[model samples]
Target: MNGPGKIYNTINKCRICGADSIVDLINYGEQPLANSLKKHRDDVEQKIPLTLSFCKQSNHVQLKETVNKELLFSDYIWVTGTAASTKRFAKEFAQRVIQITNLQSHELVIEVASNDGTFLVPFKELGFSNVLGVDPAENLKTAALQNGIETITAFWNKNVSEEIIKKRGRAKVVMARNVLPHVSQIFDVVEGIRCALQDDGVAIIEFHNAGTILNELHYDSVYHEHLYYFSINSICYLFEKYSLYPFHADPSPISGGGYVLYLSATRKNKSKSLLQFMEQEESNKVNSHESWNRFAERCVEHKRLSREIIDKYYGRRVIGFGASARSSTYLNYCEFNSGNIEAVIDNNPMKQGQFTPGSSIPIISMEGGLRRKPDIIFILAWNFRHEIINLCRSKGYRGDFIVSFPFEPKVIQS
Candidate 1:
């Protein structure tokens, strides 16, 4: 049900439950595609409605409007290897899976949305011959292949899963990191997992936690690309339908504290730790309408505070650090264009010389931008606050370095 020129799609029913009963959350209004970097200054940015909604039946949180996959993928440039923290996490994550699952080299491990084959590369290094990566990004797939990572350049769906099973047999483990929300058909993804995995197989998925997003008022996390936000409740309800059960789960600090869930075809027993985590969520008011309403009020105030801070340093050369996807949402929401942000400094060369999707802020090399001696360095990629702040201080940029997250902008002392 798609065409080449299709711009977007709308979901009236709940993404997880397939129910007509749903509740409207906050509307961030029309937003440009977050990862749609501007190659030409004259190219027009595509805009779409960025509204969030919650389901009464399933307690799932998701975006009402979904940006087409073609716009975000195809020639995707966001690489996992580009981020230092993620690179470290990928190695550790691969090792952890090996230790817990006791995965043998002969058993296949398939990673969906494996950007630049970052995680799979570690598996290959560890002597895992049966490792494969599936992604829709052509440029990234090419890079992975050149680097000796075997990859299937396609989106992971039931058809793709069947194709993989026919070629390589069922996977012992299927992995998707920080990619669940970006998927439009939530059920298709989980169903594909069911089809692709062996009887004793496991599926590890990590997604942005709705509780953290609501409690911390991280409104900037919302964008057109992020189709669905998840909580433990939402994840369980969605997976259980396809006979996949979450036997274990933990919290992740990246992406504003995500939930790392380990699911399998068979549940050996009800995990006590998992039960306790669910209890914690219930006490945290994850399902209550009041909790989200409170979050909505805070989002309004946070936006006001961020604008005031930008206005305070009016006429000062304010360049942003970390031209990340998260930064795109925040910059656009706050209306920080070239007039406000001098230029965004990024470590990734792929992003350099390109403009941010909405703000149209030019992405430049970190060293080049720091040498310009901007008065204030606003850290949009606040997740790498420590690393970025240290880099700036080491370069002798005697200016205010601000971190925005967990609260308003706080100036990090030198």
Candidate 2:
């Protein structure tokens, strides 16, 4: 069974704009902690309550409760700069900052939630006198230090922001990439940025756009860790609240499905470009509740078709690729059990020997894919489908691949 009843709530006021005008959007029923992987001997596990709600006033999607931060951030398994494309993005972003700001060699650049210092190293190589990374993950911070990147293992809250301001002064440029959505109290995170930034400094925050997620039917992105799903309209409202401004937005296909955002705090005078984009999005009905409801329906249909397709052909030899956090929702919501999926194969050695949190499906190495030689491989980590397909090909596994999102299951010949 896919859990019990759905968790519902009523929001009279918007979290972003604080307006009394609010309406219900599509709700993704109760879900467990997506990233909570199980260890061999560790039996203790916490199943936090989770639900998704949308604010009609500002079009901001948010989780109903404030889940524990430790479960998401501390001892985090996922690193920001691990993927090849993300590393390229980090390096390119650093170069662009230097070019746009005309930063002097002595100017300082800081990044919050700078996992493993992947982005900072590029700035360091550019001969920037000061470059600092602040992240709460102690292990990752130590790893960054080992890689010759200066890092402070502390959460970037108001207190930490004040300390940094006093010791290092305001940073010339601050970057928080893919970190905003994980925050429970978004206002506090924005305040921290304001404190750490110089008067003329600009802060760039990148997040997964809510419009893309809904329109593309990216239900996998819905996890307990991600507290907010931001659209340009919602983000604009959020920025205004914190005395910050969103001057620009450049949609890109960077993070798997799509990412459409580039916000700056320096421009007090709002750009017509941003307004035009917002208006265009509104015209397209991107913020309407009806759109999300329809999209949610599509997601359900896709899940049904995928289950049917897999059941028709494979019988019992199907296995999943990518034991990712998103796979948790897919498995739990679709009522998939260990019987349907023989095992999960992952490239990360840390997770290879462990089991999935909710489903308890054993995670094995990529070698297992070859050993089992299943007829079809259900790609649970659909975001990295291209990379995974290439990897399986390199490993000499010629099985068909399955994608269970956007539309019901479809097989891609490799």
Candidate 3:
């Protein structure tokens, strides 16, 4: 389907195995780019196809459609430091990386998709004197540099990795956190990781666990930016193809609960926990088409329940709690119209004046949203539901706060 801006094409072959066994999992229809918030009412909204598919051969679940990299990533707005989950994860991940790899002061460490150098800040403070970040977003690069983090304003690839190799030798640790899903060149990114590391170095990659998504029914996590979902099996399959062996992985509390895969060039004994996790996926029918079909059905029911609650409070003064990318997917999928939501409250100043992508609900400050004592508050960032509700109650708001999907639709009194 052609959209208002650039048209994207759907792929027939699997991105990992190069097999023409891709099967349709679900489609979210034409959606405006998740982070494309607008400054004006008449701004041109760029809608594109958002789809999910799975490979029958490799059991890899990915998007059939591909958006232009520049259109999606250039001048990016989502920063890693914005969310508490990400901030906490960065510090913990830095320490975990040190312990896992035995990283030293002189040994170099590199991070791809290192937005605002949130992760690199700790790497610098934790004795890794040589730390570098590779990202394409100019705004984030500027912020990273201001924080005394050395960053290259480029996407990670074999060429860029070779350049890093030439400039500052092979790195001991290459940390890629929650980046594989956004990466367009699957093979190239893996090859770049392989090329960027020393023979003994370990490349740690983190991915949102497919098991969590399937079990928790996090359909909001699916959007244009995320091109693929990863399971333990899929991670192993892709790495082994490039002679990189996956030796260790843990379901870490990074990016709202994800699996961290530790890969090296040489073979090592797979941890018992990693093997057990893979077996759990098999038992859960992670690769079966029926699981995906049931997931789609569940998602539809979730949306229906949301609309039922939202439709009840028709003319009430309702404001969305978080103006996040996930909120964009939720609003768009549930068809939450502007008349129902007065404004979206956000702590991020960058989003305050802009309007949400598809919904066009104006983004306002916390003060502005709370000033009128809204009758209904819709919590869009469900992951931070506890924090949001507590904040509302602390601010003297006793009205009911609504948490977004998967959970049964009910307004909680603050």
Candidate 4:
């Protein structure tokens, strides 16, 4: 899998267990990188097969192919501080971590994939001076530095972890939020987490829950960058392989819905909430093949229904709200383009002037979109539906809104 210029490779075995037990769950056909917004509408984009699969051996759900890490993350555009919701969550996350770990003010706290240092800022504000960030994006690292948070610009691996140990000693707290699923080298990253933490330190790993993905029909979250859709069982298997065991699990509001697992080198009694979470997953058969098959069927049906609803307003002015990565998957899967959508409105200025991948719809500022006098504002980022709707109304948008999720598309009168 190592090469100087290699782009991507198809996987025949499970990324976590290296077993020839991969089975296709859903194929999204050929799709572009979700975050690769184009500067020009006519610019040629690369499209690859984006399929989700399940590992019979490890019970891990992952993509059928691995896009090069550099290509996906090197010049990342997504930032954590852009959304108000994320900022609010950051404070809560910091408080929760401090309380759960009984973290000291002077102890080292390292966050992997710490985009723009938004999460780490709260720790520093809470009297923790030994906060650090590690991310692969140079541009984002610069942003983090400007925010007074020191960040190392490199991917998380055993070598990087060892270097950190030599420089600052092992961290008392290591948190990787929404990053475990994006790594193709699953074992390497987990080993890195094991090596980076102190023997008694808490390692918090947060990821999109595979159970929620199955039960909530959040197939729009499936993209090239996300290599694994991890179940709690699968994550425990990966961590326990390196002698790190989870003792607690709690729900996170990020990425629609997620789980934060607290692990340490020493084995400890599992929390009641963690046990309940696992039991519920087992009772619902979320990890079963039958559930996956049903989910795939629902995805197909949802796609059809979504397209049908959008087609009803084909000739009208339709602007998509929120140029999110998930929206990229949803819009491209629905075969939307400039003809179907006038322009996507996004708050992030980095994406406003760009065009969406595969779909080729221009991204615009909210004010620019409102100036167009659109008849319908399609809510593509349905996870923040209420917030987006309220923001639009506050900005004086009197148009109807459409939200697609949880089965079918619904239209709300202005």
lDDT (CA) per prediction: 0.83, 0.74, 0.85, 0.90
Instruction: By TM-score, rank the candidates, best first.
Output: 4, 1, 3, 2
TM-score of each: 0.95, 0.89, 0.95, 0.98
TM-score of 1: 0.95
The candidate with the higher lDDT, 1 or 3, is 3
lDDT of 2 by residue, 292-358 (tens): 7686678778678767876776565787988777778778777776778888888777687788877
lDDT of 3 by residue, 258-284 (tens): 798898899999988778888899999
For TM-score, the strongest prediction is: 4
lDDT of 1 at 33: 81
Q: Give me the overall lDDT of model 4.
A: 0.90
Per-structure clash totals for the candidates: 0, 1, 0, 0
Backbone clashes, candidate 1: 0
lDDT (0-100) at residue 38 of candidate 4? 98
Query: Which candidate wins on lDDT?
Result: 4
Q: Give the TM-score of candidate 2.
A: 0.89
